[model samples]
Target: MINDSELILNADGSIYHLNLKPEDIADTIIFVGDPDRVPEVSKYFDDIEIRKGKREFITHTGHVNGKRLTVISTGIGTDNIDIVLNELDALLNFDFETRNLKSEIKSLDIIRIGTSGSIQGNIAMGTILASEYAIGFDTLMQYYQKPYNSKELEIQEAVIEKFHDLTFKPYVAHASERLLKKFAHDIPKGVTMTAPGFYGPQGRNLRSQNTYPHLIKQANTFKVNGYQITNLEMETAGIYALSNMLGHHAISINAILASRVNETFASNPKEIVDKAIRMVLDRL
Candidate 1:
């Protein structure tokens, strides 16, 4: 049995951070980084059965075209991803009363409908792209016992060699092939660079000095096995890595709102995001 402190639950028996019970979720889940976007996605649902919120985690579960879906907000970064994914897995695979793993475990289909900034010149603002692979600049994966494939290792090694001056070695994680193929066939797909923060980590220097000012340039020129880092985002790497660890299928669909290379922000960011959301729902 898991210890109380290790697997904390609310007095009402829902998960601690998300305030969600197992019955409140669906097999297919959509993750958005902003809480307000939960309703944006859930509004399309034919019927919303559950609405739950606590902190930055807001969840709405409902059905569309007879297919059940759960849309939830993960707030910002991989740190939140760690909490969200672990709690979600616990909710599904553990017997809350017994605090023991269930005899039968289930894999969830997780799709992240979020916004990103393009690091490459060709990827224009308002374009919807699917993250095929993500290189995590954050150290979230360092705490986990991750098994990297040959391609992932090759890319990671190359990234380490290129950004050798950095304090940490980046890790590579890929999206689920099943989910990628199913939803992103017609859209552009490429590697994503998941930065730890929006400012220095992403090579943005507004009021602060960036230690690694050439971060974007280095990542843009990085290429391995015909795959180049195409976009920059906050959560995809964590989502992909944690999902992989928990035996879940996951993919991130990005709506490009800022162009890092062009140094331009989209005038109609909401329209692009709505387009991406509708695209994913249509595919789902």
Candidate 2:
């Protein structure tokens, strides 16, 4: 039995951070990093059954094409993913009435509907990318044990070698194959590198200097076993890594908003984002 002090639930039986109960979410969930984006995704549902919000965590559960589904906001970053995934696991695996573990557990299908920048020049703006691998440049996954096998060593080595200018060690984790087969067929497959922040961590320059001046360009050209680095984002690697360990299936669908290779931004990003969101919703 987990103690109430450590595994706290609200008096109303909702999870503390998400203000959600076991029934509030469906096993198939679509996660967006922005709070406002939650409704945008849920608006396509046939009928919304539940709506809950707390801090940056907003959840809307409903039916789409006779299938029950959920759209939730995770704010941003893997740090928030740590909170969201654990609380979600606890919500399903713990008995709210008894505050004890359940004998049977359930796995979730967590799909991220978010935005990213294309590191490769050929990937046009507004293209939807299916992450074959989400590599983390952040230190979040390093806090855990090793997440790769011998096969991914070459991919990991390539990331480390290309981003050598940075101080932290990088790790690579692949997306859920089950989810990929179902959703990403006929789409452009690429590796997504998740940065810890929006600026310097992604090689942006301002007052402070960047350790890797042409980091994005470097990642764009990186190739190992003929698989090239495709894009950059902030949440995919965290989502993939945590979900892999937590028994949840996860995948990220990215809207290309910028092109680092050509120094271009999407002329109408929300249009692209909306297209990407609808694309995932249609498949989900």
Candidate 3:
């Protein structure tokens, strides 16, 4: 059993999972899934203070245009988010040695800058997508005691009714408006669908059949009170859920890499990602 003390630190006094301390992280954090992308995103930082890595996780703390920020690679999926987000919150809000909580908990502003596919035809390749809301098809939220929004619950029920054949429970949540307003002008706003996997879960084939035949079509045409589904990714829902429960702000900005309907990929995918990262950094 991991107690508060055991969960607090490593023998070297760094954060347990991230290998970072409170001093090592900035108030503003940017998350990417690929470890190699850590340096790619941190390249724009004017002054870098720390660079650390453990397993697949890589982190860089730096300053950009006088604003301090930290970029971390979360590996992949909601399971990774479960580790990264909780540890990050602990780093900011809890005292490591004493294992005592702070009187005034500090909240961090987190933004996920990653790649995703567009389910809508109007949302083409090489464009930037900002998630106004995220629909989680993962099980992480089953452990939380946070109150569910009635409107969101209604939407979830409708979605489930429309596709009752699927095995998982549907979960939906919104992003932090405060963070969205900060980088609003940098990307197109839409609802992001969080899938469990990139292949069959997202309606892709592998020389075999899928459980949901029209899942992609259902997702593309899915609308809640007239809100159209925009992009599809794997991590944003978990980020929003855990961040909201912990009192931190979270949002996702995705570079449109693939189009499900058109079956197209960005011609210059690297260039698209580079532009999106630069734009986000400049805005921040």
Candidate achieving the largest TM-score: 1
Q: Can you write out model 1's per-residue Cα lDDT over 158-201, one digit (the tens) per residue?
A: 89998989998789998999998899999999999998898888
Clashes of 3: 0
Itemize residue pairs with steric clashes in candidate 3: none
Candidate 3's residue-wise lDDT over 1-284, tens digit each?
A: 33755476888877888999889999999999999999999988898899999998899999998999999999888889989999998888777777767889999999899999999999879988899888887788878765567766877787787768877787878788888888875568988888878888788998859888788899887777878779898999899878878888988999999999899888898898898898888888
Model 1 pairs whose backbones collide: none
What stretches of model 1 exceed 4 Å from their correct place?
none
- Candidate 1 vs. true structure, TM-score: 0.99
Model 2 clash count equals 0
- Evaluate candidate 2 by giving its C-alpha RMSD to the native, one decimal: 1.5
RMSD, candidate 1, Å: 0.7
Worst 10 residues of 2 by lDDT: 145-154
**What is the C-alpha lDDT profile of model 2 across 146-229, one tens digit per residue?**
457664678888778777877888878888999998889979999898998999878788797887778777887788887988
